[model samples]
Target chain A: MSEKAPWITYRPELKVLDCTIRDGGLINNHQFTDEVVRAVYDTCIQAGIDYMEIGYKNSPRLFPKSEFGAWRHCDEDDLNRVVGGHDAEKTGLKLAAMADAEKSDWKVQVVPRSESVLDLIRVAFYAHQVSEAVEMINHFHDLGYETMANLMAVSNITETEIDTVLESIAPTPAGTMVIVDSFGHLYREQIDRLYKKYAAAMEGTGKEIGIHAHNNMQLAFANTIEAIILGSNRVDATMLGLGRGAGNCPMEILLGFLRNPKFSLRPVIKLLQDHIIPLRDTVEWGPLIPFNITGQLNLHPQHAIKYRKSETKDDFVKFYDELKSEI
Target chain B: MSEKAPWITYRPELKVLDCTIRDGGLINNHQFTDEVVRAVYDTCIQAGIDYMEIGYKNSPRLFPKSEFGAWRHCDEDDLNRVVGGHDAEKTGLKLAAMADAEKSDWKVQVVPRSESVLDLIRVAFYAHQVSEAVEMINHFHDLGYETMANLMAVSNITETEIDTVLESIAPTPAGTMVIVDSFGHLYREQIDRLYKKYAAAMEGTGKEIGIHAHNNMQLAFANTIEAIILGSNRVDATMLGLGRGAGNCPMEILLGFLRNPKFSLRPVIKLLQDHIIPLRDTVEWGPLIPFNITGQLNLHPQHAIKYRKSETKDDFVKFYDELKSEI
Candidate 1:
């Protein structure tokens, strides 16, 4: 490594996306108060963050808007109420919403970029959903919106499955293809191999590789750093890692590591202190033992998430034995 | 990057050292109870850990007995009380204690191997104390104890200083030379460089390079894995990352990552559930905001440790400003 290695100074092309509301909604059914969402939006602008993923754009029919919060739909009125018609040109902070394959009714829910506040539509899917994800990305692109094909749960997929997904999405209009460590099971070595594969597949597509890591094994930030070192420019983080089970990479730590002069850490710190930490009373996230077990076993966090709500939440030995027996 | 990487298979030469009691003792002034120590001792044996550092061997003159605990001195009587004369032959687990440079009266404290339970004497010192550390290692080696030269706070030292210290310890009788990230400030890129540097310096000496990482950046386990990938066999971890500030690499996660089948995660999980989690009420550790800031700035965690006790502990913006002004 040279004295001027990218780790020392950062890549200028790097873009950090704050997914506090989008992923964090998984724990609380997208029920974050408008006050919390607005605080996150303001923090993203002040902190010079490149993008802020507000929430998911899943179908109201599938999620039932009566039960889920307004963010589950990310309606035009609900988004405007929180961000007041976010102007990406003025703030330099593009707004994004994750649209999961099969879960989202993109044909009707995803309006043209000119009509919505969202600048990007992140198409999340598993290996089997790659074909639909490609169509979603192209559709969103034709609607004049940026797009990313986030392949979720890549750790659980086979090498051939990953290759096929990459090949299918390689020719799409997605501006970025992300290596989503949905289970937080990947180590830096695996991140290195996956990054190389993604980079090779998107060699001439001009599409950047992104990283969206979970903190189940406490490697989210570390894995994100590893991805950045290997030239993954689009990265995802959340305030205080307030996402789903075991959260996402923390935005504060990620900003501290990135040497981009445009990024500021104070606003993020303030938001974490004032807004995110208070949510701990009703929301539980971080690399707890249950999540760590799931991450280590390369299993979905749903089991650990359910077990955390049980009376025997602290019975790690029982959890481990049960998880292992299932394998 | 190969299919059969070292990460996929076990390295028989690799040795894991559980520093739970020793490092975790810092938060409580080496005040762990007999039950806690005994539990950790038994866990190490059942988990098939190679070595367990019980505590520091500093002199009573430097640290008064009343102010500290028995682990600070690690007297034979206390060792016997907890472990019942830890027999390395029978348990396949070696007991060790850290003796800090200039603080330990090794001449009077470190008894001969035949007269005590300690199998290894870890000599921890700063760059300026390398000469003293070398002499201490030699003194302990003559007494028939295996030894390690733990260069503390390598992240704060200059390259030339590191080279000088490595040169001085190369000819010593120490069995391992540890890259101690005392401040928890190193990243994987830095770990790669430091590992290569230490490996080259220790070449042909038949000495192994070790890693003793702190988790201020939540990178302890990740960095430890990086070192292991680069052939650092002697690794240090504590249960639940229970150490001074942000703690050390977590033993449970480390055991989970290592491919060695001899190491059992069940013992570690049980220990965490039964012994470590209960201590959280009295002892606070982990990568909180204060510690994370200090780690990112490459500063000692003492300031963060002190700030964590203040009335405005959660006022991260104020803390960040004050810390930055000092820098």
Candidate 2:
């Protein structure tokens, strides 16, 4: 809430994190071809993006290697294949991968940054898993990688629960705490309240607030912008909003709003045109009615995702009635 | 700017206006079947919506009777054909129609309310047409109809020009002054700025500020919510966002957000499922890449609309290059 308009000034500390492959992987089981992945990597560098979340580092047992792509594990070799090596001087863009608190075997899967090309580790956790997420953040930090603790599905969490989690994570080694709208159900008012809470909690901890929004309500970009206006430093986006069930905020829209001259819109638009848009033929994502319904109800989008893949995609009333009954 | 969250409370004075026919008509030349139009009218009544703008009052000589449907002129007979003469006591839903300042023949085309079923005359004008729009508002007021002077394409207007226009229209007896994002280019900051200017300029005039957002940048619903939070009581929406290029704010989303007990989401969802979704096969609308480009550039979506009609609909890069050259 600066008296001067947020758009008029540029915050140099603001970092744009490209989650195209990481989030978009949810649609196609992280099976993006090497060519497409390389194109996104090159685009991120050209677009002057600060960080690129390559993919997740989940347990191979839970998500089989045969079913999912190499990104699900994000081994040292796969990281080396996409990005040459861990040479910060060679490529200005920092590489990151997510590790879910409960699903990821972080102690063994995530190697030291000196032995890998990844420079950061993003730890995603539900409200109940904050303690485990903090431990993951510590492990990643110990291995010489910048860390982010993403608390997912925050809209369903009570205010007291959120406050407790924020207070618990305040002293952690994590550099940033992300406001993840996992259900894409949050409005600007909710974002405002959550941001104020996060900012107040992390006041002297040298931590920043990051935003990762989904487009379930088609408010992904708007919600991201709201976070930025409230001084959240880290922002997540995907090319053409390619992700699971209502996608992520489109990179082109985010780049268009951020007047920081370093961020170029052309490269993101090119990647979207050449790679992401065509993926829509095979990958089913975006703000369909079922997704909208689930987002509004603050329920998991998996039910809607399942309904969308079925013949009942257009039977919005039927799906709505079922959802209401569930509530 | 309120310290308290707006969503936690409901504003009883807030009025929801359904413009599905009036705005959606732009996509299909207002050529909707009687069944579809009646469905939306009934849905609005059942949903407890305050206003339903049936269609335009433009001069048939200009728009051509052969090219468009009867809604284009909104004759009394046509109004009767839709709602059977607008029994406000029974339905509690007011009927309204739009009239473009230049395209409409306000001198003769707009019949007295005593002779028509319409209860409101919404005068849509550009920034340069404020004086003419004020005159039209006065004319509508003299005819005993509630009036709204909608200043269209507001994203392209200068602050000084908007201030002048607001000052000029403040005393015109217009019940509402709408901030119409015709290009669908505005962000929440712009909407907030415009709303504040309109509110400040019309202080003590008893004129409510309205929002008519297009979904070019996919911010229509977010922008509408922003307007409401800023205390803009008059809101306009369309079912499934079925307007011209990117469409208007979806009625279901708006109704879902408004916590008013009277406004039901089930009816709006039924309308979307049974009526609006089917129109997509015959009519092309919603946020295509080209519309996003034009919206960001503050250009009209007409060129993008024409491009979409061509075989190069998916050639987003080509459209982007052309738009950049124009800029």
Candidate 3:
């Protein structure tokens, strides 16, 4: 009971990262308007959010600029155009961008941090991509950028695989190792074990454990709360949970739960009201039945995302039976 | 770790009650069409759910029939009209209805078990209404029906008040005592303490502990899982979380989490598709920002509900600031 007092007395080291555009781009091919991005940027500063992940840094060679939006590549000029070369020292808010393993051209795409406004390069990879993720983290560090290793889809991996991945990346220059519930299938119990595992592996390494949850079963924010209770310092959320299938944790709820007086919920609410909510007509995300099914079965949200676009999107019984048959 | 193994091992005693129409009625003045009610009824039977709460059994004098729908008063003819006099023994799905402590004329409205199709009568009351709740439970018991005492808004009450209420109701003939998070303000820690306290108080009385959570903080299903982990057998959920304000724990997610072999997700999914989903145009429910704000402040959702209907419903920044000022 005493150990759980952190629920009331929040840890000062807790850092909130808003990845509204970064993760939400998965639904719309990183096509958010610059106005929306700027709104989120301003919200992060006003809400006292520690970081705001603008978008992905995947290579244009893999994702053509003509097909994808400027955010997909995060070219320095495009970033600067939207955020006006955001200064972390002035706003007290850092910038981040996800670099997917194998998809990103780290050699040429990631220039020295001095030339870029981005402060962090988050490396997202599967358990099998640990080696590449480590290399990316080390390279990003040398380039003078904060780095995080996000091991995605941990729900589908075994404890041994996680342990192996954790061990491989434990000594990296990455400042944080995130438990990314990419499938959104984990409950609090799984979160408890995973948080403890990450904490144990990173013990005395000066690296923080972060939680990047998806809201397939609508447990993203709840699981994030569970991780925070277990001493996770780095938390990821988005405005109105506007991410991929079912989206990420809502920044409004996350800020409301954290007792840090520095954090304000009004700005996030304003962002949701002014920017995120209006995106409902063009892009669809939330705990829809299809996403919930995928989350329950520990399956990737691609199938659900595709199903939602089909003519018979609401045929949930058919969706359930078909998914069950595959299982 | 062994105790938490229930996450995998099925608990046969665990009873899932679908209170879709019962709780959802709060949002629309109990105006759900008979077709929707019948659809939910059929789904409950096909899904092998243990119990289904049709609606409240409040007095017509307090809530006039002209203003409220049939389900609000839950007259026997109305219940029979929709469910065709549902038989618990034949369908294997028991029918239940909630009767508020002061709002109900239980002595007159509650027919004998032999005369009615309802099997369980849930008595809902605040901490101050414990004696009335206990009396209602006893009266319902004498009429030959299973009874449950729901202590509503436990989040607003002190631990001492909860202890007093638990002690007062421990000796009653009620078969279950529920921790009702009316405001949806409680986190996992509060759920843990409340569950333990309820379990201890009801230890020798053979009364099961139940959880009835709201989704204002989007923690309904997660908190329900937490309570279930702590040994709660009776659980309450609704289809697509359709209820007052932010809604209740979603029945679809709850069934998915429970390892019980009898429960089926397809029927619930079908119900969501065929019936509940269509209600979105007329009624609004889910974890909206206004409800989340009220939940954070530990206030009744009536304010948020009213705000959601106003001309400036999407003005969330103003809502948060005004609510915070009151606090």
Q: Which stretches of model 3 miss by more than 4 angstroms?
A: A1-5, B1-6
Off by more than 4 A, model 2: A1-5, B1-5
Alpha carbon deviation, residue B114, candidate 2 (Å): 1.7
lDDT of 2 by residue, A39-150 (tens): 9999999899989999999989999998999888898888888777555557679999999988999999988888888889999998899889888999999999999989
Enumerate the chain B TM-scores of all models: 0.98, 0.97, 0.98
TM-score of model 2 relative to the true fold?
0.97
On a 0 to 100 scale, what is the lDDT of residue A154 in model 1? 98
* Candidate order by decreasing TM-score: 1, 3, 2
State the lDDT of candidate 1 residue by residue for B1-327, as single tens digits: 346454677788999999988999999999998999999999999999999999999999988998999999998888888887678989999999999999999899878999988999999999999989989999999999999999999999899999999999999999999999999999988999999999999999999999999999899999999998898999999999999999999998898888888899999999999999999999999999999999999999999999989999879999999999999
**How big is the positional error of residue A31 in model 3, measured in Å on the Cα after superposition?**
1.4
Off by over 4 Å in 1: A1-5, B1-5
Score chain A of each prediction against the true chain A by TM-score and list the results: 0.98, 0.97, 0.98
DockQ-based CAPRI category assigned to the predicted complex of candidate 1: high
Give the range of the ten consecutive residues with the poorest summed lDDT in model 3 chain A: A1-10
Lowest summed lDDT over 10 consecutive residues: which window, candidate 3 chain B?
Answer: B1-10
| TM, every model | 0.99, 0.97, 0.98
DockQ (Cα-based) for each candidate: 0.84, 0.72, 0.81
